[model samples]
Target: MSAAPPEEEEELALPRRPPPCHAVCSSRAFATLYSLVTYALVPAGVVALIEVRYAYLLLFVAQLLLAVGAVEWSWLAFRIRQRLLLAVSLHEDGPPQPQEPTEDAPDSSEHPPPPSSDVNQSEEQTEAAAARRAHALEDQPLRREDPRESYARLMAEAMRAKSFAIAPLADWLFCGQWYLAAFVLASLGAAASVALGYAVESSVFGSANPAAGWRMMVGASVEAAFVSIFCSSLAPSGADSVVLVVYQACVLVASMNAYLKLHVDVIASDSQVDPLFIILAGAIVIIVFRVVTSKVVMQSLLLVLCDVLGLVCIVSPLIAFADLIDQPMGHSFRNQFALFVLVVVATDVGDCLAKELQRHWPQVFQWCRHPLLKSEATTKDVEALAISLACGAIMIVVVRLGSGVSAFNAVEVIVLLCAMALGQWCRLWMAHVRQMAKVTTSAFYLSEGSRAGGVLDRMAVFLVAIIVYYPYIKQKYFSSS
Candidate 1:
């Protein structure tokens, strides 16, 4: 039988395009619903706090819901934006080029060679080849699953492959990206806030034990300096140099302030140890260790240390609070120590989980190639929900058990957790914004080099410095004569 004419063959070769209307509508509807839910969280949280007697519990629930909504919305938005881009490309470029035939398809060599003939005959052979290419391309199945759905399926598979404990650590360590930086800032901020709060309270009450507040302030300032230095080292040309200088100044001023306020007879006394000296020694050890070990080994060691410290902190607080174990440390000391340990543990775990997710993302994407059912949820979603619920439960228990404890102390712990949560969300949201801008080519979105955004980035470091040293400022200048 004679092959069809070139025009008819070419027309037949093109794959049927799905109606854009249905996909666009569905995407927009989901985006709108997710956005509404995300926005509603703030009001819901506020209302929960105002109306509910146990507002913290309700607020926690609201935050958890908000987090889930944010993730879903982000994934959906990314997919929708991608689809739109594809549509635009198709419109501008005409039909997509035909794909090459698979190995399973009939070999071109199997057919008898066409005879060298007139130009018309050559054109007819070319049309036949194009028709076969189009048919092969059309035979390939289109992806129907949403990106979010795929992510969930992958997470579920990962969970099944690895135990809960190990999988989370790997996921966080690999997938976390910019989240680690945010967590560090948040933990530092929370710790600073707590220290500042205590100092303010001490000043107000005219307490003799100002040493605790002074020590906390000094430690926080030193930590700020270290962080600044670390950041400056990473991005030498970036704005971190200015931050490093500012933090160094803070450290110097804070140290001098601590010395002036806390008098000691050094000449008559025996050799005394300084906390700053201890901190420096530890820093030196860490630096040396990192230099000696491979990056992976160093990270593994750090993770292990954090896990050990976290477990110790979790148990220590319970033991001290219950009077099951005797700690020479004061009640305030124990409480603050527990708070610091908890913050460290939370941030470390988060960082590890993020890293692990990133590491295994290729496998996740591969696994997600298959279509997912609407009713299915990802392991990450379930795990996140579980964590939120567990945290809420623990907080409730703490609140109940510590009914006799001072309200100020309880509030301090709550504030610390809230700060960490806020910082995490802020980082995630910023990442989402950047990703959206990248995908959509939206000029309205902030660029990396935008001056306003840079200033805001620097502001985080600046705020930490100010908060850390505020206690010292109050003690030195704002004190009653």
Candidate 2:
């Protein structure tokens, strides 16, 4: 009979290998775990009830994709484990070690090593050794390609990250039932804001005001439309650029809208009715601001100012209606806004911690007597964990306190100051990291400056301009004092 084909012969060979010793094959368990935890528990059907905003549904879908990516991430870890296990098993079954050369050959220095006579023999031995090594190396690369390896790596990374978990958490939050939850909360906040805005205009300010509550709503719609259109146009450039531009625009428009609405409230109470005049004036101001500033420093300063202006938007109104700060509508709105700030702050802190841990942990553990895998209770590691926990806790507490404070009060100013100070401070200290972070963060989710030289050039000019304009502006608009 003809010899059997190699594939059939191999398949017919008796199975020599034992079953995997570990229940999960150790390598694949975490991948299975991640899939279950992230997809089944988090980012599932539950989040929808919490947020309840239609816009959040889009966010939720994005988050679901992220979670799915994470689930996929665990594959690396599984592959690594499998490779390690194979290595261990192979090592256990490998041939016995050969004996060392007896008495060795004559000492190399004394005999000058047996030269050309042994050259052919030595070459043959070297070639044989090379063949053996090459054979050993053959399966390693193939083993490395295992999908589980990626999942394992991602798990290890996720476990270590602290600062950058928001995007991850957002994925988790968006994918599951909690996505609904986030939607609901956002919806409720939006609805509450709209209702309060209307009630304030119609009941408190009177329907006869120059810009009715309805008109304010229309203005807000226009502003939002402008932001959406601009952002969409930029989207084709790249996700990061799109996110950054859109986020900045949203912040700017929201701030400007709030500022304009507050001003409209004041004007409606007493001023003239000339829609074209206000529009023309606004357009002129925009042109001047855009035209006069060409330098990077000026542009960055303007960008920050616009961001700060968003806070100013909500702040101005509360300050104007200080008596209403304690009222239910005002207090509720303030709490909600404060919560948003807290969330952003929390995200920043988490991302920073995760990044720091990622960069420094290897060096920090290098000097230990035993590696972390063996040492369960290293003081240094404990200290690091403790510090991280403490910081996270303090942030949570501070955010809670912020939420309780009335908007436009001392607490509110302090919070706003904190936001500005932290933003600038981070911008200064983590300039490079921030650039990297902006791109990385935007890659998942979607969301600069410098200035002049000398002390006098920077401060004196700045002071003179501020002093000259501050009084005039305050006297014109904020002159109750």
List the candidates' TM-scores in order: 0.26, 0.24
Candidate 1: stretches off by over 4 Å? 1-233, 236-243, 251-333, 347-389, 392-417, 433-481
Which digits, one per residue and each the tens of the lDDT, describe model 2 over residues 1-481?
2344333355457353221121332334544563354334533332332234221122222222322222111222222333344445445676334323222222345434336777866776566656655654442333222335444433333322122212233346655332343344435544555565666565545545565435545444343333333222222112222222333333333333433445335333244333334333433443354345435444334333432332232222222222121121322343433333343333334434544664576565456435436654344434343443445446556756754543335443344334433332332332332232222211121111211111111111112222233333334334442
Q: What C-alpha lDDT do the candidate models reach, one value each?
A: 0.36, 0.34
What are the per-residue Cα lDDT tens digits for candidate 1 across 108-156?
6864456666656677777787787677656543334454544433332
Q: Judged by TM-score, which candidate is best? A: 1
lDDT of 2 at 230: 28
